[model samples]
Target chain A: MKIIKNLALGVSFIMSTQLVSAASTGTTLETVSPEADRIALQNFYKKRFPNTELQDYVNGIYAVDADSRTQWEDIEAFPPYEFDVEEGERLFNIAFANGKGYADCFENGGIGIRQNFPYWNKEEGTVKTLEQEINECRESNGEKALKWGKGPIAQISAYMAWTSRGKVFDISIPDGDKKALAAYLDGKKFFYSKRGQLNLSCANCHVQGSNIRIRADLASPALGHTSHFPVFRSKWGELGTLHRRYKGCHQDSRSNPLDMQSETFRNLEFFQTYMSNGLVVNGPGSRK
Target chain B: MRKLTTSMCVTGLVALLATSPASALTVEESIAEGKAVYMGKSRGNCISCHQINDPDANLPGNQGPPMFAMAQRFPDKRILRAQVWDATKNNPISIMPPLGKHWILSEEDIDAVVEYIYQF
Candidate 1:
């Protein structure tokens, strides 16, 4: 079956230098069934690594590589992001210039709601991510917006994600709205489309080549990729938002990174987060 | 006489352009250069995704097919060159970087790597 998929991909590659749609593999996002896409993706991983529990994917590459898992376990024993989460909680409570706070901007006082983010805002006609909303919340409260990728923004998000740990993602798209579907499809196209001088799509590494070594590191699976964010990577020696990691991957592929919370990126978050619907949230995670 | 000279000049230019970078090196040097590019983490990094018959290859990956029997697998060296240049041309899902297409490796580097891999 892998051989067949490769052949189909080869044929599509011949058809165009860019925009090689998933149509060749019959997993095309042309259909309006996001549920089907989610199911198919889940099944793909289940078959690929039969021993991997669905919940385990939140660990990213650690789920597939036992040696890495051992190291990760040791790190988790004394989680480095504890200080970041504490700082975030402190910031979350501080009053804005208007005497209101971030709690005033969100339901449930903005706690334990990380999984439902990157949702379709029918009135706004865009996907709003947790990071974007955090900035928006600050701006609406007359506070200066935090930077999108790292620093305080990532710290705040880390606290929120920590509160929502073990809650499975439950993202949804409005069935009647063409705009919502269009946004999802746009993200789907972005995932499969080849870009940059490297001619790599997101799927080339994360989806098809998951668990594969690239030099010293492993290409993580797309499944549950959105679950863990606000990662405390040893490489950075600091916490950062999902968009920051996304930017790094783009740069590695020799492509220019898009602005954080850009429409394209939000849509991608929507698609990826929704695909991880049944997976548990496990963010503020540390990694090597 | 002028026409003959012009044709000869065109042929000479074509020959110069067609001459591969490897042609300038002794066989040993070309293979050594290719091996460096293949093993370098920042260069071809082929060993990151592929296994090779070479016992000296340190911790090669199994993500891609092993790089042995290349002389048999790709009978035409040009096909091997194209594959290295951009494996996606043959398999879009292939995670192999388009080393030449992306300018990740110079033409000279690719030519050398191709000569080295062709022997496998």
Candidate 2:
């Protein structure tokens, strides 16, 4: 029984010692129930910002940051992303030598299909993002894949997202599909799991830091944070895609950001977009 | 003779186990480890939130307070340790992560992080 005694001692030591939350393990995490998670997320933001409307979240931080709203409104009135949207439309309509275009590769002639993206592609057994689909469309039509970080990728996505304006995000995990559900949960854990030398998660800023000032900037709530993508940042003086922002945030937190369009990112977008369900799409946004 | 051999083997194992923790590292080694974690992208990533006086830290964050005169602010190591364990305990709304409580860093890593920060 010497082995048993040692095992007992180890168990006792663990019980006596400070035990950590088990949800953050990178591997072997059970798929969290998505409906419960979504309801809980909605409840959390509701409690955090009791004064804000459910629909107003499309405006992002402006829904909560009144002082910045006026400037945001002014920016929106003459949005910096307008030219990019126009350019994106022009690119979207362009065809290849095969006499086919982006429209031939998607449903409804590829119009108003933004909210349907970042979906679980069961055949691929991975989440598919709009950027990936865009490139896939290009390749299928015998055209070169557009670079992912910015420029053409951002431009085309901007046009697609613009067309989807006022279409509430409808991301879903197909019924009874456990792998899809597992990916969704993994995405949720990624959002909550702390990383970087600063040991922070996306929730650390967006979820917990909402209405809290960090060097004069008000953090947005995580509930509808992903509604806007292919946003225009005045700081960069150009448009950037969602993955670009993901990389920027990870680096800012001192974590090694997964490569753009990596599995983790595709899953991350799936989770974030699913959380943003029912929030109106208002992309090609202008941000400070 | 068999019993004696078993006892001797057990004694040797016990001795090795007893000395392992004590001989784990010198302060200099711990400091080096702390520096690596503080600067490395995959580890503590301290530069993401706190700006330190170290020359190696580039593009330091302004989100949190500068990591300056830390040992003076909380002379007791426990005070600093408590903050690292869970800053939320002190302020419920604190944006800082509980490096220890969340399993982000193990106990020894937290100790190293504290030691490294104290140097700032």
Which candidate wins on DockQ?
1
- 10 residues in a row with least lDDT, candidate 2 chain A: A7-16
DockQ for candidate 1: 0.26
Taking the tens digit of each residue's C-alpha lDDT, what string does model 2 give over A106-224?
Answer: 89988898989889988989999999999999998789998898999999999999998889888888888889988887888788777775566887788766655554466777776
For candidate 2, the docking band is incorrect
The number of clashing residue pairs in each candidate reads: 0, 5
RMSD in order of candidates: 6.7, 9.3
Q: Tens digit of lDDT per residue, candidate 1, span A176-197?
A: 7889988888887788777887
TM-score of chain A of each: 0.90, 0.89
lDDT per residue as tens, model 1, B1-120? 656655654554465457744468876889999999889887888898777777679988756777777766654455567778877777666667789888899988998888787678
Residues B15-46, model 2: lDDT tens digits: 54454223266768887888887777667766
Where model 1 places Cα greater than 4 Å from the true spot, the runs are A1-30, B1-22, B53-56
